[model samples]
Target: MRLPIPTLALIASILSVVTAKSSTGDRVLVVLESGIEKGDYSKFWKSLEARGYSLTFKSPKDDTAELIKYGERKYDHLIMYAPGQKTFSPALSPQSILHAQLDGLNTLYLLSPSLSPLNRDTFREYDLEFTDSSAGNTLISPFSSLASDPSSPLIFPAHSPLLSSSPANPVLSPSTLSGGPIVFPEAISHFAGETPYGFPILGAPRGSYVGGSGGNSNSTAGEGRKGGEVVLAGKMAGVVSAFQTRDNVRIGFVGSGKALSDKVWEASVEDQEGVTHRTANAAFAQDLTSWVFQETGVLRVECATHWSKTGGEVEKAEYRKNEEVAYSVSITQYSPSSGTYIPLVTPPSDLQLEFTMLDPFVRTPLILNSTASSAQGSTTYSASFRAPDRHGVFKFVVEYWRPGYTYLRSSTTTAVVPLRHDEHKRFITGAYPFYGATVSVSVAFVLFCGMWLGMGEERGRKKAE
Candidate 1:
């Protein structure tokens, strides 16, 4: 028998809930200030949901404010959008942020007018500092332009392959909206003294500064007059900045909240809604969120070595001049899923090996051998070439760089010397004529001496008789 309409509806609702739950396998926790406009991120967040991300909303007042528990990451991603006073509760202290990072949770900090409170001395332990200063101002360009009209809403440009690769998909189409001019009252500045692993995604041109009337009284300059002279100047200057940890946790900071406001997203010049430009903003948000959520790819070279084949090991200290030497290099790439390193095929083609004394003697490209295999799953590059005729000191070098890969450099030094006295051949094709002439002269002199001695002996015998 067919079920009643109420029963059918209930079954459908249950199925829908199950599907929704399945769709969001990973959770994205968003921490917002009590009364901020969060609708600006709606489209961006929906885009992320479409890509299989589950989102959670919370505030500093939540009973469970801390993002980590029992040394485990509670959320895959943490987004702070326009936080206000006491935004992060005491439980979510700087230690909590550090722990979450250590646990590999990604973070994205969105800025607004009231970000100063969060940047207080209490949070400095987390490697983030917020200043009321505004001297740091600069603009970035997208990889390409997005404006339909010559004079339309502008969007920020981001062409770095790192931003587009893997977990971070720089939304190119949506960034077109960022082509128009963007005006800012204050710009966030990142300092020079940051963690070695921290990378700046966007920044102002060096020496550029935001000029404003009021200086930040709360800021401390290294060795200058009070705040206004250059409250936020130098290396860091951008509305948005990003940093990455050694463990790959990413933290993004947007200096101003209005940068992502719906009014800004929907704003148009001459009453024409610039949807194309709008797409860029949405794409930027989506890309950054994806990066924080661990959807991007990170490639690193584990090992690079070069050696001669004769000894079956890396070449030793020296080689004879013009000696034929075989060279090879082995490398491995990292895989997060396997939790083990694996050999890489098609290692970058640009890897160059050079035999140089002072200048290069033989500079040649290394070709990876697809036919060769090893337990490491790595491909080997091999070549055989004679050492340079003239050599004192020579080195083999390889420099490899690709869009999203860490650089690889390999070099080995070996001394090459000329032939020793006994090492030279007794006779050579080029010296045959000289050898023949010397032999002829030696024979003639021997015969002449024998004849002269015989004649002298005969004369002496005759005189005695």
Candidate 2:
């Protein structure tokens, strides 16, 4: 029997809602200066809605509203969009925001400098610092012929491969959208961060610093700055900065609020030749949102297990050195483009696995196992190796790190031991020659003992005679 058309349509609508709810569970908290539709940031909110996010709004002054409560996160992501405000609601204190991030909330922060503004103590904890004084620098590049001026450092080669690239460099676009390099006219210049926490992911071009109160960073290590980053050091500053918390939660810094505004994000300008193109801002916004919200670059270790090949024991936590062990794990990546978690990534991103102790005893590349399912959204990679002759505790570890993806790490340990004395067989087929030689020596010794006893008895009889 076929279903009626009306009934089918109703079913489809319900299914669609269910799918959206399940694909991405990103509950977003957008703290702004005012109401959503009442503000000039309607377009920014629209871009997020397009990505299937459920959003809640809180004004900078709405301290009574809780961003989180009762040790349970009310939201999965947070966007601090009110840059010009002098202060925020009590709920948005540095401690509260940091705790939310620790609870796995990815946050995007937009900052601007003004005298006597609210202190950004939250950013400082993440190592993002801003001086009280303003900058005389422009984030422009002098080398690019496309630079309409010396200040817009976001200029890329007109024919640069990034323009037509897919996935938009994570800050550029989701995989489903096309993206080019991003540029903003009014970027706030700041000093760079150091290793791990302070690594600069984006930069201004060379020959581009106009020092003022926040003068040329004494950090001019490379690209004209001292004690600063080598590759990230450009003329005056780094435009967009990002870092991942130990929980794999991401945090990104956008230099200006105007850069995310509707006009700038979608603006297309004409050059001297009348060639027109849109700013990469729109795609950048989408991509950055996806990344910070855990919609993109997410990795999960669904399964990790090992078993002895000879014993066929997956449950055994101990094994003998002679046994060959099979190690495998099921890993999946959250695809923001498709809005679902999948095992394999397009263009074949690599996943690395290590078998180790103090050092890697068996280091080998993992091959994608036969067990992969598109429906289930998981990929299995596996390897087999003989247990080392040395006896001790050993572990299987997998660490997968990519520029745009969340870091993935997991481990499982097992004990390897030598065979007990009683476990050894009395005789062995492989040592037949040694066994036979031992038997022959023992028989000869018995015969020799019997002959010596007879000789002793005969000597005693002769003495009595």
Candidate 3:
């Protein structure tokens, strides 16, 4: 039997609420390598589904898996797990992927040691340079590896120095950081250039090095030679990295696909010291996906207002020079658990505001308004300062950039006009001296003229006598 119209509408609303997981959108495209089964990373897939994402799996050879259509993104996010595949669909080309990201599609890229030239060039565009694959470069660490075999995978212990993180980094939550070690197999070392948009998520251990011979070698990266040279060592090596465009498009690069495999998620790792540790791969994978999918570290400016403190006027089109002004902006951060934007209780201490013309005239920190923030599910940051003495078209700009978080930028423009003639002071203390001098000069000139006329009259009377 056909459902009633009202019932159908109700069902559709429920479905919409259920699928709204990501702050951006819920549509995800998973591009898999040929012959790879979906069950290979079942846990990862399930987690995405649980979070309400609608995933579409496609092979690299599938022509129908287009990321863009009619100059718009078909999917909100793209997951390319087909590492080491030499060929890809034309719609998924490197340039195409880059353009899709520009169109606001977040992406995740899993890579292998053997990178095709196309992949290399693509990553290079993001300032990520991997070790030379032709030289048989493999990341090896005797102390961190499971065994003496050069082919053995490496393990990062709890709070491993190799896993670089910051409190501000949303990619690794506090629980994940304090959790079990991560098992990294078939690790390919790479280097990240100095780019503000990109940063390394995982660094190589102190003694780890990438060289041609994947064997136990004591030589550092500088001393390696012969058939294979060490291309990266220590902190210079990175296994995982991330890039976020200015438009808030996020991209993640994992050097090894096995790291996200179900087998690795359940596997335990033992270092050379014979200490066994549970794998945090599952947690790491979730966090990575959560971030790239815009489920975490997402921020939105709800509203911003500026007004003259003295006049109590808000959102005026123009402001007078030297007026005390107050600016406040409401910001909300996306919460995956609630599936909504919530107040940012603890905003960054460095959140700042700048009043700018050609250059910044006023720069100050934006303080949190606790009462206002608690009322709504958003944080309100406000700053009060005197408008610059110089008058011109000025902008109230707030630029908050932190790694693993969305770049927050808000700019509001208003003209700062010179004071009106009636607004000018009737008397200026600094001009008192000039005023007194003018009056004295006038009086002296009048007395001189009177004396000259009196002398001329006396001379004329003497001549008549």
Among these predictions, the greatest lDDT belongs to: 3
Per-residue lDDT, model 1, residue 182, is 35
Q: RMSD per prediction, one decimal? A: 10.6, 7.1, 7.2
lDDT by residue (tens digit), candidate 2, 253-305: 87655567776666775433445656677766766676667766677788888
TM-score-superior candidate, 1 or 3: 3
Give the runs in model 2 whose Cα sits over 4 Å from its true position: 1-24, 34-38, 113-121, 131-153, 157-181, 197-201, 210-236, 271-275, 337-339, 347-350, 356-361, 370-377, 425-434, 442-465
**C-alpha lDDT values of all predictions:** 0.54, 0.63, 0.81
Backbone clashes, candidate 1: 20
Per-residue alpha-carbon lDDT of model 3 for 1-465, expressed as tens digits? 999999999887766546558888989999988756789889888877866989998888788888899887899999998766778888887778888999999999987776777777788989999887444666776567665444345544344332444455677877777787676777787899989998777776677777745344444434557435666777788888899999999999987777887887857766778877778888888888889999888998998899989876557888999989999999999887667888874587778999999899999999988898888768998999999999899999999887888999999999999999899999899999999999999999999999999999999999999
The TM-score ranking, best first, is 3, 2, 1
Runs of candidate 3 exceeding 4 Å displacement: 1-20, 148-165, 214-227, 429-465
Residues 147-188 of candidate 1: C-alpha lDDT, one tens digit per residue:
332111133454332354322322222344344333222334
After the best TM-score superposition of candidate 1, give how far the Cα of residue 273 lies from its true spot, in angstroms: 17
TM-score of each: 0.52, 0.75, 0.84
